[model samples]
Target: MTTAPVILDRAAIDAMIGVIEGRGHRVVGPVVRSGAVVLGDLSSTADLPVGISDEQTPGRYRLTARDDEALFGYVVGPSSAKPFLHATGVPVWQGERTADGSFATRKPEAPTPVAFIGIRPCDLAAIGIQDKVFLNGYRDGVYGDRREGVFSVVVNCVEPGGTCFCTSMGTGPRASKGYDIAVTEVIDDEEHWFLAEPGSDAGQEVLAQLGAAPASDDERVRVENLLVDAADRMGRGLDTEGLPEAIKASMESPRWDEIAKRCMACANCTLVCPTCFCATVEDETDLAGLEAQRVRRWDSCFNEEFSYIHGGSLRPSTYARYRQWLTHKLSTWVDQFGEMGCVGCGRCITWCPVGIDITVEAAALAAAAKEATHV
Candidate 1:
């Protein structure tokens, strides 16, 4: 059966949080942290980043005050849902020497269930990509349990950031799937409410607890119109018609050298990216070698040592590293996973010190391929 949309006022939102917490899950949502809006623990509706909007461009991010008290006024910030699900510096196992020169090992305890609110549509897509990475084929039990236990509340975009390209990626402006509950915030001179729809049985139960009234047809139409406006306002776009093939054919394109000149290879892009899931494991032991632990920490392809082998590093040049990163994200990933690795969140563009835009580089590659064909 199709679930009816519900209208949630400010008070109802607060009640919704309380109701979720009552179900033994810690509620996390967007909050003003330092100078940006980031996901944090929510004790009440007051913890949300109300009336704050973020301005994002290539190599820039800043928070601005919104004219209205709209709770979900901002797009994404530096953080995504990755840290909660695929955490860094996590201990995989610990070992201790026994009396007879043997070792004992044990895995860490399971993580707590998390209820995430105000997750952007792009981020929701990112989580889906990671699900394939960790939960497909061999399947990572740790990541799977945490991810499966999440109660996600996706907030569709009404105001996209300057670097946003989710619309072009077919990931967002408005969420289509992978959320327990989705909401669109509407605030005007006369009304301030959210048109909420449940995507799962759990979401339906939570809404039932809030006792939120069903939304009218006019309210739903208003939300659809606003989403359309948001899609049209996207700051960037990528033509993905033959993107994977074009990127693969541009293996020797001079564009790599051009991009490498400005590339720092500092791994900031990979570090901030929600879907780049490369990691390295390290084993540590005490001076006496009595106790030791194996830790799995996040790694990046931009690092020189990441490609080190017996003789030397495979990708010794900056151009080679940059090419590898972009090619894998846009081209090779599709071959491996049957989906592109990027969701067009543009965190890499906003956080890069040199402000390198992936969409621009991808477009340039496609253009170069087209010119070559003509010649």
Candidate 2:
């Protein structure tokens, strides 16, 4: 089926806010926070970061103002799309009276419906990768429930981040699917508007309320050009041919030792990664020992306890742990799942305490493999 693209002016976006907020769902989007763009609760179109950009490097981050007011200027920040799917600091319990003398358990509260606005294409791909882990394999009830009531509005990247390599990963620069509505911001001498395309029935309903018209062929061409340009601007790429086998074969390679010496074993990478699904469950009781509750929190493989086995930690050394993480993400992940674990969002590269880059590591491994083959 063919539907004409629509141009959503600033006023049209405001109308969309009314349409969305009028439905009783709170809108979460990008906003300027402490000199950086962060996802938070937004009430109006003006609440978005209009003219700002971010500079991201391994172990460092900085935000800058853009020449023109562009709402989606920045790429991504420390926050991933996970928080929207899996809530943090949720109250799982409340005190209740018990028959004996202690308190009883109360049911967990359900998360409210949320509409995520201005989600990047790479982030959308990351969310899809996570869906394979949580929704496809195990079908987590919490995730399923949260996902059922949520809506996604993705924004196409006009400029790629320095660390970004989504094009190499075949994940982005343009959003082909996964969102309820996909939008590309177009700015020209005379106009600044969003080219909107509805990807689902819900998106269509929202579009109907926004009151947009069919886009011209020139407008469609402009959007395509923007995506292609962004894709070409990617700063990093990975050579994934035989990556899994190469990583498995190089299990005892000296690269691990070299990496470990520079690595600080911090959990920053996992924390920023949208596809990292490791979590731990904790059970806690009140001071009176009457009421108790169980909670699930985000976990990281960088922790020594992550690989604990019967006797002790399987990966006791930092080298072993680093190897396990990189190999799992780039190589073994594809073997376990049909698709690659990473979406090339560059979060790991940007947030690593030691500035360790996975793409560089993979390339080194590939080079080493080639040299060995020749030998």
Candidate 3:
């Protein structure tokens, strides 16, 4: 069902703030921090990152002022939505032993309901890919409990990043689904407003409270054009047509060795990746040896210990580990899940300590496969 689109002025957004605040939920969105746009808790419209834009590259990030006061001034940051849902340093298990050797256990606290505003379309797509691993495959109760209370208000990308390739991944520039409400900002000398569409009943209720006017056909056309323009500005892309087969064929290719020499094995790629889901559990005790707890943290296949088995590690060499990571992300992930593991957000490209690009790697493999086929 399609609800009529609405044009929301800045004043109308303030009204939305009241609606959310009245419902006893905190609002979090993008704000300027250390010369970059970051997702954080915000109280008012003034707290948003206005007149700012971010420039991201491997091992470098900077924020610049924009001519217009656009709320979503940047593409994405190093952090994704994962930290909000599955918290770091979470106490998975807490217990105390009795004198009789019996033990008492305490459950972890649940995450509070959060209303997230200004989420980008590609990020929303990344959340969907994450759900495939957390909710679909394993049905993680911790992630599920936190995700259930999330209310998302997605914002379309007005400016794509230099490493962004969401268009090639069929993810975004425009958010088609997975959000309660989708907003496209329209800014110019004369007009500064948002064209919003509600995808859920909660979103419709929020829109109704905002009292925004219905958008004109011309305004809708303009928003669509903005999305198209963002897509056209993409600076990176991957050809996924034969990616799985191509990656499988290139297992013995020399490209892996070249990359391994450059890779630092710092696991920054996995940390920044929106869909890399490997994790490890740890148990710890206090110094006095009175109490103990178990925790789970994010783990990466790049770690040398990740492939450890009974006798020896399966991926003993850096070349093998790098190959495993690239293959799992672009190739075997499709076989394991019905969809590609990556959303083309380019976080891996930006956060790699040595600036190793997955797109370039894919291109090299594709070219190598073509040459081998010709021979």
Candidate 4:
């Protein structure tokens, strides 16, 4: 049965982790590493990035200390649920030479189920977008295997980063869906706790195990005010009304050439992006030629060889590659996946070497399209 809104004290976090572990899930959450908050194994609430916050802008990201001892005070760092769900360097299949002159091939076993904690709402949206990419058409066995029975706990964003624009993309500062449980952290002069609500049967059971108490009306109002403030504080926004059509129409815009001058084609944006799921596979054999394995690795459209076929690379120029990447992300992705590829997590803007903001580029293309329409 769906439970009422509950209040979980600071100690309840540790209890929640223990319960998830008790269920045989490898618990992972946000932790401090290399001076940044990234997803890692969680043994207790102490392992979380408590009292830490992040400063993110175009081409920069830094970890800073927060005034309060809020356990989840920081925004998302470079990592997301992507690496865990769609793992890289996975062996698709291995083949061995049999005694007689034949080859025996076998697919790799499915991965163990995992429980994710402290997931941001934008990342939850990103996971949904990836679900469409990997689970819809052919049903990728590897991603499907990893995605099964995975428990997700989403943490609402009450303090968005400088580069974040989830609100503009209709993703969030609040967890709308795709979570087993949702939490909103509250820290003030009086108390520090979480307002938790179950989104699924498993979540209700977990909260019951924690003995979470029913939340009061005051607590609910406080959380609503915090979330509304956070929404107003979003650092950037993209006007997506006619964005896809504008991007598709601006194929010949000179704005691409301007961006190409600073574009490094380093693929850092795709690597950090939660939804850019282009990948390529390779077959390798041992020196003895007795065994062979096919490996699937993440790829990027910015690479010159990515569009290469037998004859030559289709998009050799940096401008053409950039155009292709943006077009696919905002315009063509809707045609392919029924939605935009980006969830507005802002990882690309924060991690780009030259600070090439996708939102700015898209606006430029839209303006160019409007000017052309008037002519």
| Among all candidates shown, the one with the greatest lDDT | 4
Worst 10-residue lDDT window, candidate 1: 140-149
Q: What is the C-alpha RMSD of each candidate to the true structure, in Å?
A: 1.2, 1.9, 1.6, 1.0
Separate clash counts for every candidate: 0, 1, 0, 0
Give each model a TM-score.
0.98, 0.94, 0.95, 0.98
Per-residue lDDT value at 3 in model 2: 49
Q: Cα lDDT of all candidates, in order?
A: 0.90, 0.82, 0.83, 0.91
By lDDT, rank the candidates, best first: 4, 1, 3, 2
- Best candidate according to TM-score: 4
The model with the greater lDDT, 2 or 4, is 4
Instruction: Give the per-residue Cα lDDT of candidate 4 at 278.
Output: 88
Residue pairs in clash, model 1: none
Clashing pairs in 4: none
Tens digits of per-residue lDDT, candidate 3, 1-375, equal 558889998778777777876776768788777766667887877898878787877666678788987776688887767777765667777887778888777877776777878888878888888788789857886678778868888998878887889998999989899898898888889879999999888888889888788999999999989989888998788998888889999999999999989988888998888778788778988886667888878888988778888998898888988888989888998988878888888889987878888999998998898789889
User: Which regions of candidate 1 are displaced past 4 Å?
Assistant: none
Residue range 305-367, candidate 2, lDDT tens digits = 888889999888889888888888888888777878888888899888678998998888778
RMSD of 1: 1.2
Worst 10 residues of 4 by lDDT: 137-146
lDDT of 4 by residue, 233-339 (tens): 98888989899999988998989999999999999999999999988899999999999999988999988889999999999998998899899999999999999
